[model samples]
Target: MTINLTMALVLAVLYAVGFYLLMQRSLMRILLGIVILGHGSNLLLQTAGGPPARAPMLTSARPEEMADPLPQAMALTAIVITFALTTFLLALAYRSWTLLGHDEVRDDVEDRRIQRLERRLAESEEDAAEELEKEATQ
Candidate 1:
C-alpha cells in the first residue's frame, strides 16, 4: 500500500500540536487541541486505506478500481463525533467565561493535598537514600 507522505506529515504535526495545546490550562487552547487531534485521527484513518482511487460509487468502474467506502464512512463518523465534542467543549467554556470572566482551569483542594503528600513522600525517600549512602561510605 502506497502511503501519502503529505498526509503523514500533517497528521504528525497535528498530533504533536494537539497534545501540546491539550496540556495547557487555557480552555480555548484545549478546545483547539481536541480539534487538531481529531484532524490527525481523520488523516490517520485515510492513510490506513490503501492507495488513492476513484470514489466507491455506483459508477462503471470495477470494484477493484473503486476506492474503499469503509474509510470514508469512518472518517465521516469521526468528523461528526469531533463536531459534537467541540460544540460541547465550547459551550462549557462559554458558560465558564460568562460566570467567571475567564476560562482558566483551577485545581481543586484535593489536587493540592495530593501534591503535598507526594512532596513529603519524595523527601522521605531522599532522606533514606542519603542515610543509606552515608552507611555505605562509613
Candidate 2:
C-alpha cells in the first residue's frame, strides 16, 4: 500500500530516534526506544493494509470494502509483545538500580579482555609487516 509523505517521514523519524536511544547506556532510554520502535512497527503494519474500511466481521459491505483483519491482528500482537518486553526491561532496570544505585550499563570484564587481546594481535601483525618491509629494503 502507498503511504503519504508525511506519514512516511514520521515513521522514519520514529525509527531513527528509537535506534539512537537504543544505543544509549541508560536502561530507561533503551526502554523508551523499544516503545518507540514498537509504535513505528505498528504504524508500518497498519499502512500495509491500505485505508480502513468496514469491519471484517460485518457482512453489510462487499468483500472488497471490508478491512483486512491481518494487519489489525498483527498490530495487537505487537502491542502485547511490546508491553511484555517493557515490563521485563522495567524489572531489570529496577533490579540494577537496587544493586548499583544507577541505571547505566557497564562493560563486562571479559569483553575488555577480548578487546585488549585483539588490539595486541593487531599491533603484532603490524610490527611483523614492518619488520618484513625493513628486511626487504636492506
Candidate 3:
C-alpha cells in the first residue's frame, strides 16, 4: 500500500473533525461529520491500493506495471453510498426544521428508558454471577 504523507495527514484531520462534529447535538453538523468521515474512509481505501498507474489492460501495459482497479471501484461505490446517505440526511434535516423550527435532536425518552432497563439487567446479571460464585465456594 502506498501512503503519501500529505494524504494521510489530510485523512487524519478529516476523521478527527468528523468525529468531533458527530459528537455535537446539531443535525446539520452531524450530517457534515458523516460526509467528512465518508470522504476520509474513501481516501483511506484508495490509498491502500498503492500509487496510481496505467489501466490494467493486458495489451496496453506489462502485467507487473498495470494499476489495480479494485481500489478505485471500491472508492466509487463508497462515494455513491455516501452521497445517498448525505441526501437522506439532508432530507431529514429539512423535514425536521420545517416541523420543529429547529434541527437540534433531543434525547429520546424511549432510548433513555431502554438504557435504564439495560443497566438494571446488567446489574442483576452481575449479582447473579456473584451469588453463583459464592454458592460454589460455600
Candidate 4:
C-alpha cells in the first residue's frame, strides 16, 4: 500500500478512539479526545495531498523529482488551528472544573430531568406572579 493510504487508515483508527473518549463524562478525557480528533484530521489532510519532496522555496531543483507543496502548507495551517483550539478547550475545561467542583459531566438523563424540573418551577412562579397581578388589578 502507498504511504498515503497507510496514513489514512491510521487516521481513521485514531478518530475512532477519539470519538469513544469524547463520549465519556470526564472533562479531561473529552479534551484529550478532541485533541486526538484534531490530530487525526490534520494527518488525513496531509496524507490526502501526498508526501512532500522538498520545500516550496524557489531553489534550484529538478522539476520531475519535486513532490506536491500544497500538503506542507495545509499541514502548517492545520497545526496552527489545532494549537489554538486545543488551548481554548483546555482553558474552558479548567474553568468548568473550578466552577462546578467536578470535571465529570453530569449524566445526560439526570441533566434532562433537572432541566424539566427547573422549567416546571419557573412556570409555577410565573403563574403565581400572574395571579398576583390579577388580584392587584381587581
Candidate 5:
C-alpha cells in the first residue's frame, strides 16, 4: 500500500516530542509525553491499515475493496492500554505531589552512596595495578 508523507511526519514529530518529554524530571511532562506517544501509536496503527474505504463486511464490498479491521481493533486496544497507564501515572504524580510538594523526580541518596562506593573501589583497583606495574619494572 501507499504511504502518506504527512501522516508519517506527524507521527515522527509526536514520537520525538513524546520521548523528549518522557526524559524530563517533571511528572506532568512525562504524563504529556505518554499521551502524545499513545496518540502517535494509534495513528501509526490506523495508517498501517491503508486508506479507509469500505467496511469489512463481505456483503457490503468485495474482499479486495474491504478495509482491514485488524488495525482498527489494535488501535482500540492501544487506546485502552494507554488510558490505563496514564491514569496510573496521574495517581503517582498526585501522590508524589502530596508527599513532596513537587512532582519533580529526584536522585535517590542510596543510589549516590552506591555510586561513590563503586568509584572508590575502581580507584583502589587502579592504584593496585599501578603498584604492580612499578614492581615489575623495578
Candidate 6:
C-alpha cells in the first residue's frame, strides 16, 4: 500500500533470496547473492528517509518539505563499495575455479585428512615389506 511498506517487503524478499543463494556451493551463485543483498540493503537505506517529501537538494526547497540527503549519500557510497567488492570477489572466484578445477571449496575436511593418512600408511607398509625382503635375502 504505502511506499515504505512496499519497499520493505521487496527488500525482505530480496534478502531471503540472497540468503538462499549464499548457502549454495557455486561461487557464481554466491557472488550473485552478495550483489542482491547489497542492492536490498541500499534500498532499505533509501527507504529509511521516509519517501522523499520534496525535491532532494535545492536552494529554494522549504525547510519543512526538505527530503533527507544523508540516505542518498549513503546509497551512493554503498554502491561504489559493493561494485569494488563484487569485482574482487568475482576475480577470486575465477582464479579459484581455474586452479582447483571447480568453483566449490571442498567441504569434507575429515575425508581429506583420512585420505592423506591412508596414503602415509600405505607408504609405511611398502617400506616395511621392502625391509623384510632385504632381511630374508641377508
Greater-lDDT candidate between 1 and 4: 1
TM-score, cand. 3 vs. native: 0.81
lDDT of 6 by residue, 58-131 (tens): 78787778888888999999899889989988997999888998788557989989999999999999999999
Clash numbers, per candidate: 0, 0, 0, 0, 0, 0
Q: Stretches of candidate 2 above 4 Å error?
A: 57-60, 135-138
Candidate 4 lDDT for residue 41: 76
Overall lDDT per candidate, in order of appearance:
0.91, 0.95, 0.93, 0.81, 0.96, 0.86
Model 6 scores a TM of 0.69
lDDT of 3 at 88: 95
TM-score of each: 0.76, 0.86, 0.81, 0.64, 0.91, 0.69
Q: Is candidate 4 or candidate 6 better by TM-score?
A: 6
Instruction: Give stretches of model 6 more than 4 Å off.
Output: 1-3, 55-59, 108-138
* lDDT rank order: 5, 2, 3, 1, 6, 4
C-alpha root-mean-square deviation, candidate 2: 2.1
Question: Which parts of model 4 are misplaced by more than 4 Å?
Answer: 1-5, 57-59, 107-138
Residue range with the least summed lDDT across 10 consecutive positions in model 2: 55-64
Candidate whose lDDT is highest: 5
> lDDT per residue, candidate 4, 22-65, as tens digits?
89988889888888988887787777766556554457567655
Candidate 3 per-residue lDDT, tens place, 10-92, comes to: 99999999999999988999999999999998989888878878889999999889988988999999999999999999999
Q: On a 0 to 100 scale, what is the lDDT of residue 83 in model 3?
A: 98
User: Residue by residue across 13-111, what tens digits does model 5's lDDT show?
Assistant: 999999999999999999999999999999999999998889888798899999999999999999999999999999999999999999999999999
Q: List the residue pairs that clash in candidate 3.
A: none
The predictions' CA RMSDs to the true structure, in order, are: 3.4, 2.1, 3.4, 7.7, 1.4, 10.6
TM-score of 1: 0.76
